[model samples]
Target chain A: MLGDEAEAEDVLQETFLSAFKSIDSFEGRASLSTWLHRIATNAALMRLRKRQPLSFSVDEVTEPGNGNLIPKVFYDWCCLPESELMTQEVRDEMRAAVENLPDTLRVVFLMRDVEGFSTQETADILDLSLSAVKSRLMRARMALRERLSAYFGGAASADMEGTRYE
Target chain B: MSEKHAHRDCSHLLAGLSAYIDGEAEAALCAEIEQHLAACENCRVVVDTLRRTVLLYREEQPAPLPEGGEAAPVQSVRTG
Candidate 1:
């Protein structure tokens, strides 16, 4: 969403308007949410692309601001005393970290981790291969691990110490 | 830790980690993985990390959907 509420409103209006017009063309091949998500993602990306100039390689253009898109969170999970473990504050931070994932990664993570959906079900929702779903889920975890490294003491290092979850 | 678990690393168990955490891993493999985790610091850390993450995931309740725009226009809509 744009920093402005009004702008976000406008973008959403345009997206739904376009969706309504082509609603009849949608087949039973995909879930309604999946189809709409595709349209909405396109609309949102198009709006952002217009405002930001992209570099073109051949006919494909890469958006300018994409490279500098920082996540909303930058907190470390470690350094806290064990006394504060599983506090609401920590849970909220973890939720925010999950939300900070990119759209594709977030969707995959939600479907697999949050919803307890099978990899195949998630693949269907995202129109991706099972391997692709697994790959994205792993990437999502890695990103989260980086964000949460302070608390977990870096899984890579912890792993070296034989720190399994049990 | 059991001998089978003590001999395995996280990389070897990554594919089955989620299932194992979900308590869906087979009894034999689970015992082996558990043993390995107790002996191998790296795998133990991986388990701890994933266990904590899964706990966080379980506590996540979706926030209220935005009221405006097409933000979540059709969550209840069934097209099939």
Candidate 2:
């Protein structure tokens, strides 16, 4: 999410204003909400670009070329019950993990996964090619999974306790 | 399964797992991924957790709307 409240407000206002002006262009291809979201996402991306113009590189995370498919860390949580996976602490960790993603990956992941947009919708919204969206999304999910695994894998509770005592 | 065959490298499969999980992959690719998953524990765990991550996130409420600004009604946007 764009961190600055003032800037986010500006983008929100601009989104609706622009949406109003271009209401005629609403072809009914996407739902009204998706269209609005696309506009808002573009507005936010523009603000992000202005603040850090040089940081918007699609190729920052290298594609996994032909190699072993082994994960950096693997903990089998398939045996864990769904109730355990859905704990508030885990949810908080997941939110934090998503927030920590790089902007490019974060936006794509949020649009596709969090907002329930199709991959194509996300690509269109962010003006990214489909492959780029796919790659960024994969990387984002992988990063979050690795981070969350630390929590579910039992390393996080000790860290949490240390923070509490300190 | 033989060690060589059992530890089948799945880089290609891993690359497509996101699309596969999202139901975006072509049927053939989905079949391939399923076949690989049937034999590979590592890929299975990665895919499973990645899926749960998405589900957990979807369950979260959308970020609070900008403070003090309710969503403009659809009627207003249509008229203005």
Candidate 3:
């Protein structure tokens, strides 16, 4: 999501304006909601592209060197109670982790996961291949998983009890 | 198995994991991933945590757009 409220407002306005202008071209191939989402996504991408260039090289943190996606450090948090995992602090961490992702990965993850767009729809919206969207999504998830692990696996663990591993 | 084959297998399964968790993977691939996950504790942990992370985000309420923000009426576009 656009971090600035003002910028988000601008994008929303621009999206409506653009969609309005191009309504004649609305071929009914995609649903109205899908079309509007595509416009919104493109508007966001335009703003993001202006702020930073797309990252073509994958980050080294989750790069599959030996064909293994193994985390440098892994902790099992599967047994943590939902009450603990759903804490406000954890929610904030999730938001921050997502916001920290590179623009390319973040956009795809948002369109695919957050917006509930199908993989094919996301790919078409972002003008990326299906495989590319999948790869970026994987990288984004991996980075977030590692970050959340570091958070919960460290000091946070002290505050919560009954964190068991299988 | 040779090191190369073992690494390839791991890579293959790892690459397909996101799709598997999303219920997008083919049945054959899902079966293979499930089989691998049954035996590989590390992968099981990764998949488990990754799934939870996505779920957490999904459960969040979407931030509301600015107040009184109305879409441009489609009728205007059609009429124009």
Give the lDDT of residue B65 in candidate 2.
71
lDDT of 3 at A97: 94
Cα deviation of A36 in candidate 1 (Å)?
A: 3.4
Residue A91, candidate 2: C-alpha displacement in angstroms: 2.5
Error of 2 at A17 (Å): 2.5
Residues A31-149 of candidate 3: C-alpha lDDT, one tens digit per residue: 89889888988898778778766453445334645222445435678678988888888888888998898777888888777889988898887777888898888878878887888
Candidate 2 chain B lowest-lDDT run of ten: B1-10
On residues B25-78, what C-alpha lDDT tens digit does candidate 1 reach at each position? 789889988887676654665555666666667666754435743434443233
* Candidate whose TM-score is highest: 3
Order of models, best TM-score first? 3, 2, 1
User: What does DockQ come to for candidate 3?
Assistant: 0.40
Candidate 1: true contacts recovered, fraction: 0.11
- Top DockQ model: 2
Candidates' DockQ values? 0.13, 0.44, 0.40
How would the docking of model 1 be graded? incorrect
**What TM-score against the true fold does each predicted structure earn?**
0.54, 0.77, 0.80
What tier of docking accuracy does candidate 2 attain? acceptable
lDDT of 3 at A18: 89
